[model samples]
Target: MKKSILLFTTMFCLSLVVFAQQNKEQDESSDTVKTIEKLKYKQQPGLALAASKIFFSDKRYSISGFGEFNFIPVQNNVNPEMGDLELYYSSLYRYATFFGYRLTDKLIWNSEFQIEFLHYKTEESHYEIVIEAFFDYLFKDYLKARVGFYPLTIGYVNNNDEPVMFYSVNRSEVERLIIPSTWIEFGTMFYGNLSPSWSYALGFSQGLNSQKYISGTWIRQGREIRFDLPKSISINPQLNYTGVKNLTLSTSGYYGNSGQGEFIEISGEPVEVKGKINLTSAYAKYDWKNFRFVTVGTYGQLGDTEKLFELTKDENGENGQVLGKEVYGYLMEVGVDILPYLRKGRPIHEKQNFLFDTHEMKLSLFSRFERLNTHNKIEQSLEGLPRVESDMEIWTVGLNFNSRENIVFKANYQHRLNKFNGDQFPRKNIVETGIGFIF
Candidate 1:
């Protein structure tokens, strides 16, 4: 089934490419249209195209791709006494393809599909794909409106390509295991530069719910937690302000109610479970000559309620069934970049040329701290699923070598500590290495 779905997706994309190219040669006298026609035929579909100049052209139409691999060695001690500490492996396949075309010089459309955790083990499958699509209607250089499935504009770390930007092949453990990455869903947004160095986005999207992918035998992703909110919907608003040529500050927030799904209570009566979630974030970044720094912090809240559970009662009303409890959690992180020997012509430094330049050899040292906790509350109406809560922390450090602005190689290590009250899971320590480039 998965293979068939993948095949269909590939065929559909290829058809779009061919159709666009065929239409490009039509007798369109407009230069704007001509430019877009040229772009339609030149988009690079995979990582192999990153070095192709045609894929990076400044025409109104554009296509780009990114790919990265991560490897982690872990020491598990959560249930150490249950057994000897075990060594484990965690890796990530992060990649994305983006395409855009102009409807005029001022009106452009863009779409992107991103893939992550390409090979994480699950009871059903070791790999799964997450998709994000976008359609932007540009009004001008500073403002645009969009409708599609896109990542919520929450944090810088969540939006940027991690592999091409950082030395560590993996995201901070806080970001890795807690705050979901490549997190996207159906929605619409208003985005564009509000002013010079300043921009904003106001969007409303469908919140993630677990029931959508659950089957009779398995819960697809990893764990089967009932996020009982009906396609929990959310509203996100954010603003960015730049006071200097190389520095910008941003802040954003989210509010929504989730409906996990419908279930029956032990009392033989049916009830609906629904709750709310909220999030807020603030971040800043600075680039001064060869020095760079960035930091972001976020807070989130998950709500629980007894009224969200349900049960179907017989005429005599004898208690016979119950459902799982409610759950909630939160997370945050901060990091910085320090380049000591940044040189202009090195290969590593060359990869990031559009974003940075080497006056000297490039060196970066950075670290991040994160935290997350979730609690499940039991109700007499629900049974089987237990009330559980957990606390987790992650610390990371790394050195980045920029051979040029568009190329880099990096190595880093992390120590993760997890404490749980529901189950005796162990703490873990991990190390990672990575290399990336962009032309």
Candidate 2:
């Protein structure tokens, strides 16, 4: 079944590419219709072809920034052991500044510095810093080289997360739990377009640290702040196609060893165990008239985990690092623009005023469903070890109001269902609101 689906996706992308090329040729043969089509395409929501006007025409240098703020007014605590309702006031979710410079037509550099301030009802407030810097050398339309620290392209949101590009107050649960968002690492990458509508990226980077590979979330093992350099490496590859108008398809994966060439002392002997980790994911997006749809699925596995458990055991002679042999997650969402319907025959272009001149005001209602299991499967024969049940299902319903192509206001309600040790686990339902902008 999986093979069939893969084959169909490939064929569909190829057909779209052929169709688009034919359309382009026909448009070139005409004049009046071509102009009208170009204007219509530029008027589409979420398309920002003129954003680069801020940069020097000679393309010497450029600068940009983005920020988001969130507020949580109401929430219900589901910890049966506690009898208190939780309330989180507000927070500076993210603030980032970007810089870019072009050394020549074929060589360029880009960098970003981001700050995050997080606060919780039961946890202390803290701040985090993330930096991404890279240089790109373009050889041709089919090939380019990049080196430095940048976000790994393991999934869609990891590299393409702009504030106005998504419809949620917060990112999806699958992206946060299954694959780390804004997960950056030092690496060398090669990427470019394979055809007019298809592209690919491949890279190698530093691997994760097994010592921090806990049971509930393996992604936390990322060596973001290690004092020493990583001895092992990871390979990442991705393929993307946007042949069809308003449609996109992508697939990506990562493979590597997280052991960092460490030796474990077991039974009075030094033993070497290479703990391997593998992950793969695929996603698709389609926009039709007033409705939009998106879906994504991912799977991950770890090898030699039983030996890793022994090496990272707790002080009580018990293995606390019972890493799962398998983990998986998926999410699906749908959204619709309701402002057109509410206006009763008034077109989007007519609703624009001076403040919203270059963009049309939009109101969208969206819903997302997600499921994930960190402990989908575990190693057997580990005597007296308790099973870890980290399965969860989540539901989010939200509304997004876009004042412009680069600014938005969002509100959402989120519900979580958790399972632990084969029983229902207490969780929370939250009401969240936020505003985000980019320039």
**Best model number under lDDT:** 2
Q: Give the TM-score of candidate 1.
A: 0.66
Quick one: best TM-score, which candidate? 2
TM for every model, in the order presented, reads 0.66, 0.78
**Cα-based lDDT at residue 35, candidate 1:** 22
Rate residue 335 of model 1 by lDDT: 33
lDDT of 2: 0.67
lDDT of 2 by residue, 298-357 (tens): 999988878888766667866456667888999999999898789776554544432353
> In model 1, where do residues sit more than 4 Å from their true spots?
1-57, 74-89, 117-125, 176-178, 210-232, 260-266, 305-361, 375-390, 421-427, 437-439
**For residues 331-406, could you state the per-residue lDDT of candidate 1 as single tens digits?**
3333344443342354453322323445424667766665644323345444343322235566777777666444
